[model samples]
Target: MEHAPMSDWTTLPRAFYQRHPTVVAPELLNKLLVRDDGRAGRIVEVEAYAGSEDPAAHSYRGMTARTATMFGEAGHLYVYFSYGMHWGSNAVCGEVGQGWGVLLRALAPVHGLALIRAARPAIRRDTDLASGPGRLSQAMGITKALDGADLVRNDRGVRIACDGTAPPPEPVVGPRIGISKAVEFAWRWHVPGHAHVSGRGSRSR
Candidate 1:
């Protein structure tokens, strides 16, 4: 499917994110994550994290300095450094203080292919450029500096945009990966048979 031209891309409205993560995660498939530098990617895999009720969520215990961004208004970026090694980014969702988010697990390269390749020289194949959360962040130059950045506003130089590519009609559903707790919740959604999807999991109802 052809992506809409950059001139036709529209940043997603705040209203689009003012809902629970589960409701927003699957819908985010095929949308474009854009950077002002011209890097863009088609979202293909995601995992929803519901605060409080979700034991695996970073904000389940309450707000802390590290998790403050996760509790902020919807449509903002919530980036976190993981394992003291790499960063992962999430789209914060729901109302302020609700702490819901969708982890962007993988993206299909759509723009700035040369730049993406340059950023991830260690990756031999283009499909692996942003196949995992940590790799995705590195591929897009996202880091702690971007935590809490506003994704609804282009003022941040990064935003989620729609290029008229519709999400998958039947996304593969599975449990979230790389987490020790809440292993049974089927909150992960990915485009079926997409090569860029991060990991394998049992597809559930």
Candidate 2:
């Protein structure tokens, strides 16, 4: 894993995540989530999980060891296991102990197509590489090990950096996907017509 140059790239600060989950979600668009090995994916889709108040959030029922990272400081990764098989990741938002975070729903492969393809052999087209939360996590080599990593640092195993990208078409909002709980909550946000968005929310979005 090599650290990419900071030229034209700036790690997003913690203050950027101090707002509400909904506010933080759409704002992540176009930022590059770079892995230590130089694999970078441009964020194009996301879902906000508002703490305690929103039933879909892991923090809704209160904090456990598994949900502890969601309650930790902002600007950290909150990777988790899902469906008893795959891993999914989120960028923690809101204040420390707030438990709000934005699920990294999808990405447009940017920095390492070959590496991401090796990580996900079932993928034939590049658009399918990170079209869902679990696939996004797997494609980026993110696992439970980076559950609480600081995404605001350049030296970390994974970091989210600004790339001066023009914002995608305005985000489209829809109900949260996959989970049965709070299925009606319109918290999912994604770039309209972006091929990288997950299947679960496409119809509604």
Candidate 3:
């Protein structure tokens, strides 16, 4: 299927992310995150992590080598490693000096199910292909290799692009999942009724 034209990086100004975390979180759903392999994945869920005030956000500690990208220009990809076994993806937000990030929590396979399944043979169902942060990263072939990459550029072969579709209606929002801090932030956002949303309360919204 023909996808929507990609979003221009220039259009995503630094101020865009500083406005409201919650609104930006759900607005990202259904957008396409394209990889160099000619495959695209539809974002299904996201979590907002504001500046230093958000305890769960890496920027909470100020700038570190690991989080410097989150403070850079907007529209950059801030990838990190966790659990000694998985990688997580985040989108940079706010001004160059400000720290903000939008964690990509899950995805709905769009244009590369066969490739994703080949990479993850253990997945027995379509919904399982990219239903969690780690799973989505793995399925999309993302890793530390992509740390600090620009999501609005194709140089890395793993840039995020728009697929010309608006997000689902009334995305659900609740507390972020799998974190010891800022558990009450209620920043997680996802398509209200998508079967692939990760974590609990998948149906409550």
Candidate 4:
């Protein structure tokens, strides 16, 4: 599908994210994540992580310096370093202190192709530019510095915008990847048959 013009997009309101991660995850599909420099991509895959009951979540035990962003008000970015190597990005969700968020897993590049390529020089396919959480963060220049960036207020010119494309009526659902605890929660969601999806098989139930 051809990418839509940026002029047609609108930043999602804070109320859109003021819900449980499970409710916001699947609905995020097809929304555009826009950066100030003009880099943008359509969200295609995500995973919902909740507090307390969700042992895999960083805020499951309680908020620390690293997870403080995750517990902040909704409609903000929550970035974290993973495995001492790569950064992963999430959209903070639910009310303040709720400690819920949606982990962005993959995106279909929509704008700033050249920038995405430069950030992911090792990648050979366009579909691979942001096909994983680490890759997505790298492609979009997300880092711990952006952990508390506000999406609703367009802080630092980064925000999640809608481009008139509705989310999939039936998103593919499966267990989140690379997690040991709560392995059976089936919280991951993605656009079905999208080339940019990072993983396959059982994730498409």
Candidate 5:
């Protein structure tokens, strides 16, 4: 499918995210996720973790230093330090004050694979590159430095671009993995049968 020319990401308005959760999740697939390091990638998988209403959502507990980004303006980056070692990236959604985010679970490399590999040499197979949230952030050089950066424009150095290519029809949604709560929500969305989807059972989830 043809893609939109690269342009500044215009933060999606509040109403855009207020729509049904599942609808927004798969719509994000195939969008361009570009980093300042000249490395750009495509979002292949995502998980919509809703507001406090969703037990599994981080915002379920209210505001904290780590989750504050999730509550901010729409289209902002909500990055979090995890596992005492890596960072995960999410895109804040919903109304300005509602505190919702769409977790960018995995990416399909489209540009700068060499740079990604140089950063994470342990990723030998092509499928492993940017296959998980933490790994994708590290591989793409997304860190605290980029926390709260605007995804709507390049002034902040990195931004997501709409490629105009709709995600494949029939994305699969199921229980989110590696979470303690809301596991029953079945909120994760991924390409139906893509090999690069990060986790085991990705096809099922």
Candidate 6:
């Protein structure tokens, strides 16, 4: 079957991220994250972390080489290494010098299954392939090198784009999992009952 073309789909603008991270997180649920290698995923789960006030946020302690991306313009990548092993990726939001990040918790692969499978060979089921932040980053070939990459530019190899569709109704909102500080905030959001949504076992938000 021929897939419908994505002609009407537009890359999300930088102004779309001018809002707070919590506002951007849920709206990103049904959007598309496209990679340079022709792979794409429909965002299913995310967690928002506000700058300065959020104890769980990296920028809470102030900016450093590792967190400089989060303090830049909106619509940039904020990739980081976790536990000295896996990589987790986030989309930086809010104004310059003010920080906010939306952790990409999970996604449903919508295009280039072959590429995703190649990137994550151990995944037996497609739904499980990108069902966590680290897994989503690994499956999409996201690494520390993409830390400051622009996610909204039309000519960029990686971008947060649209597929001309709307989000599902009734997204589940919950506290961010796997973080030790600021544990009570209900910043995590996910598509209700999506098989691709990460489980409680995920190591990070």
lDDT tens readout by residue for model 5, 1-205: 3434455434334455555456677888877788767677788889887777888888887888878888887777888888898999888777766778888888877777788889889877877888899988988888887888877655367777765566777787777878998777777888777766886564453
What range of 10 consecutive residues in model 6 has the weakest lDDT sum?
1-10
* Model 6 misplaced regions, further than 4 Å: 1-3, 154-156, 200-205
Among all candidates shown, the one with the greatest TM-score: 1
Model 1 C-alpha lDDT per residue in residues 25-142, reported as the tens digit of each score: 9999999999999999999999999999999999999899999999999999999999999999999999999989999999989999999999999899999999999999999989
Q: Which residue runs does candidate 5 get wrong by more than 4 Å?
A: 1-21, 202-205
List per-prediction Cα lDDT, in the order shown: 0.93, 0.85, 0.78, 0.93, 0.76, 0.87
For candidate 3, write residues 60-171 as lDDT tens digits. 8799998888888877788998888999998887668678888998888777678888877898998988889999889889898888887665648876656457787777
Q: Count of backbone clashes for each model? A: 0, 1, 3, 0, 3, 0
How good is model 6 by TM-score? 0.93
* Candidate 2 overall lDDT versus native: 0.85
Error of 3 at 142 (Å): 0.4
Q: How many backbone clashes does candidate 3 have?
A: 3
Question: Worst ten-residue run, lDDT, model 1?
Answer: 196-205
lDDT of 4 by residue, 72-122 (tens): 999999999999999999999999998999999999988999998999999
Model 2 C-alpha lDDT per residue in residues 52-131, reported as the tens digit of each score: 88987888988899999999989899988998998989999988888999999899887778899999998888999999
* Candidate 3, lDDT over the whole model: 0.78
Tell me, what's the RMSD of every candidate?
Answer: 0.9, 3.3, 2.9, 1.0, 2.6, 3.1
Q: Give candidate 2 misplaced runs (Cα > 4 Å).
A: 1-6, 200-205
In candidate 5, list every pair of residues with a backbone clash: 3-163, 4-163, 9-152
In model 3, the clashing pairs are 4-163, 4-164, 36-157
Candidate with the larger TM-score of 1 and 3: 1
